[model samples]
Target: MLALPKPVKRAIAGPPVRRDGQQLDLDIQLLLRLLTPRRPQPVPPPEQMRAGQSFVDRVVAGPEEPGVRREDRTVPGAVADLRARLYVPPPGPDVVDGALLVYVHGGGFVAGDLDTHDELCATLAAESGARVLSVDYRLAPEHPFPAAVDDCLAAFAHVTAHPVEFGAAPGRIAVGGDSAGASLALTVARETSRDGADPAGRPVFCLAFFPVTALDGHTRSRELFGDGFLLTGEAIEAMAGWYVPEAMRDDPRLRIAEGDLSGMPPAYVATAGFDPLRDEGEHLVTRMREAGVPATLRRHPDLVHGFATSLGIGVRPRQAVAEAAGALRTAFALLGAT
Candidate 1:
């Protein structure tokens, strides 16, 4: 992995500390030290967007794990062709019956692409033994709201309809992502469940890692950890503004916490203790369960937002991803058995 910038390295040279009643993991503290001093500029002009993407790429990129074959392809999108990266693990008896996980990468709906999340997708594919498809959805300020959502729906429909084309089982499909991508997954799930028009399919399960469930940033977690933990309140606000139209900020599609999640598929939500989005992500699962939907919550009490993207830095993230992958495998196995 590449070394963090000089100023960031200097910031990490200190004893570990605690925040919000949780002891920050040493790795997370180091990550925060790497990110705290330098704030990323808002993504608008083409140049700024590229710079933001480059920064995240450096922060999260890591060596690809072995045993996974990666392929880059394009899927039909609502407007134009959307780029997608597929990760197929080595053949094995443990591989599910051609299960496919359509993963969306997080960049606050503004930055990040196929390359930034390349290793994470490979890790998921290798760990779960399921083909993982990482979508390069349209970003904000250019594509804006509904563009990314539309592309995700279209991509899911395409993959599910032509499972054989993607080497996936007919009915075994799941959706997952981190941060904004998680929000997109949930939104896609809600839309699919509501439409019921896709006689061909719906997601069987969902794995969200610290999702941005609501646009309103008044939650306790936001108030507590919004400043120091990489994802700050100002940053989230800026991204949300760019992604959502002023009048549609409260739309259920964007603010998933307010949406009716009654018929949603089984879900597993992972939250970081020091993440500003923690409360909302946990709350979404609680709402799902209350609506008679099967949902599970896993809170990493010592980590911060984007922990999963830092798998190369520590064991916690890798372990978390492995556990989520196990849950995904078990879900598919149960569906196959049924």
Candidate 2:
């Protein structure tokens, strides 16, 4: 094996030590602290406008670091147009042959958009040597279940079919997102496989960041992390109710863990320690492996949900994004080579 550089060696060695014996990684901790509420905000009523507003606020204001170019564009498709924010990394000319990461921003199918996920998308592109296409897919209550899923699938297909238009390698594509977006990525991957066109040669891999895999509302984390953790059970359940209609609550497309993982691509799943969806994410990882799909699950024991979106501000949250980014790059590297 080739010798790694000093920084890379150190990064591999793990995070720095603290005097209190509570050592934490710099990048991983970034999002954790940023997402941690400043002062406890009372849980908003389920499916209420105020709750949705609060959800958007946390995501948008979490991380706005310096140095990442952002651009907005209208992604034209057959049914509806999708709003997208493209995150172009700083000039690293050597990092050519960039792949396209069609990202669906997480908002529980209710709130959240390009602005909320700006930092993480840019950070991923810059760190992973890929172009991040953050899709502002339609939200819920106004849009609902299959609405966001349809938009995500359309946006991904549109981008993959016309890679040159987005300055990406036609055969190199990946899908990812945090929370609701992550769940959608899983759905789209399955749908793409069924069709078999794979304009970009199948999504190379999926980054399921704290994804809500099973929406039956029976996981233990939901009760354990119901209160103090950044995302309360009440918030997640409400978000689920808004994103998915009463009729399709049990649909495997939205509730990924219940679906067949038979031919899905390799996945790198991140689970927040104090998150209600943690068990679901872990379950998906286990199922992926059981179904012969390569997968790895990383649980941030001290972190809460939505950590990756806060990459630039907090200690643990930033570290979480960085860690996820590194995993993304490595996995995609293998996919690209294959």
Candidate 3:
């Protein structure tokens, strides 16, 4: 059964035809079900959530079968040595030839880590023909705003500075993440561009997956999907408050889209139809294009935020990963030509 919001229902009432040839609307529909709040069915401890996610990773993500080779490793980044995992496809030669994608996991700046995104990274490595480095940045509510940002920046710097150490071609490196992680990717791109001190004096392309670009809580999507969409306004507010301080919300390094986007690298932005951060992601895309930065925006109307990250479990998860891989491939090709 597909759980849909009133607005989403109304939007799809007239048409049985799928826009992107997707027959089933599992992404958004199931998300609505998950968001519906079912009277708190046996709430468990926070550690249990991690345990459950680990179980999901084991079962759904499973052991590497034939074509994939995964490993856990760490690199020293913005913060103290950050934890990271590397996913490389089989065949040693292809590892060096493939593009490198450094990923940050999304937990709204609070939860999530490399374990949570294990399957997604594997899928990306396989689909995009790119080695994926999943970063476990320091979470918020403990680390706070600049801590997360600094951690991510450090990860980016470490990767971009020493691509060969990670078995990557420095010229073909890209940064991306989901939700808060996505925002970090955008910010890193901005900060990196501002410095104009690249290893070879080239900017890094970015892939932002349903990123929460704005923290001001002023967007329409924020209000619409605030509640009953798996992510409520209160939840977002709490996460924002936990991750960022009121005084530094306007800081360009913290808020990537808040500042000028000129000279930023080419970007591919994804937005979900019913996500609170939908418009913020789109707005950034518009701003990037307006600033003459090569940009591409794609909206999965029948999807919600976090769909890409959760796709490893459901049928639609693979599709979401494929979409992101396609975006990465496209961005790499675009950047390669220039």
Best by TM-score: 1
Candidate 2 global TM-score: 0.82
What overall lDDT goes with each candidate model? 0.83, 0.72, 0.72
- Model 2 lDDT at residue 192: 75
Instruction: For candidate 3, report its TM-score.
Output: 0.83
Give lDDT tens digits, candidate 2, residues 15-120: 5533222343444333334444767775554456446545645544444545567888879643678788887776675243767788888767777778767767
Q: Could you give candidate 3's per-residue lDDT for residues 216-324 as a string of tens digits?
A: 7588778766655565677677677777878887777765666678888888888877678888889889889988899889887666667766654345556766887
Worst 10 residues of 1 by lDDT: 1-10
- Ten residues in sequence with the least summed lDDT for candidate 3: 15-24
TM-score of each model, paired residue for residue: 0.92, 0.82, 0.83
Q: Rank candidates by lDDT, best first.
A: 1, 3, 2
Candidate 3 residue pairs in backbone clash: 78-154, 226-232, 226-233, 311-317
User: What are the RMSD figures for all models against the true structure?
Assistant: 3.1, 7.3, 5.2
lDDT per residue, candidate 1, 81-168, as tens digits?
8999989988888777689999999988888788878888888888888999999889987889989999999998898888888888
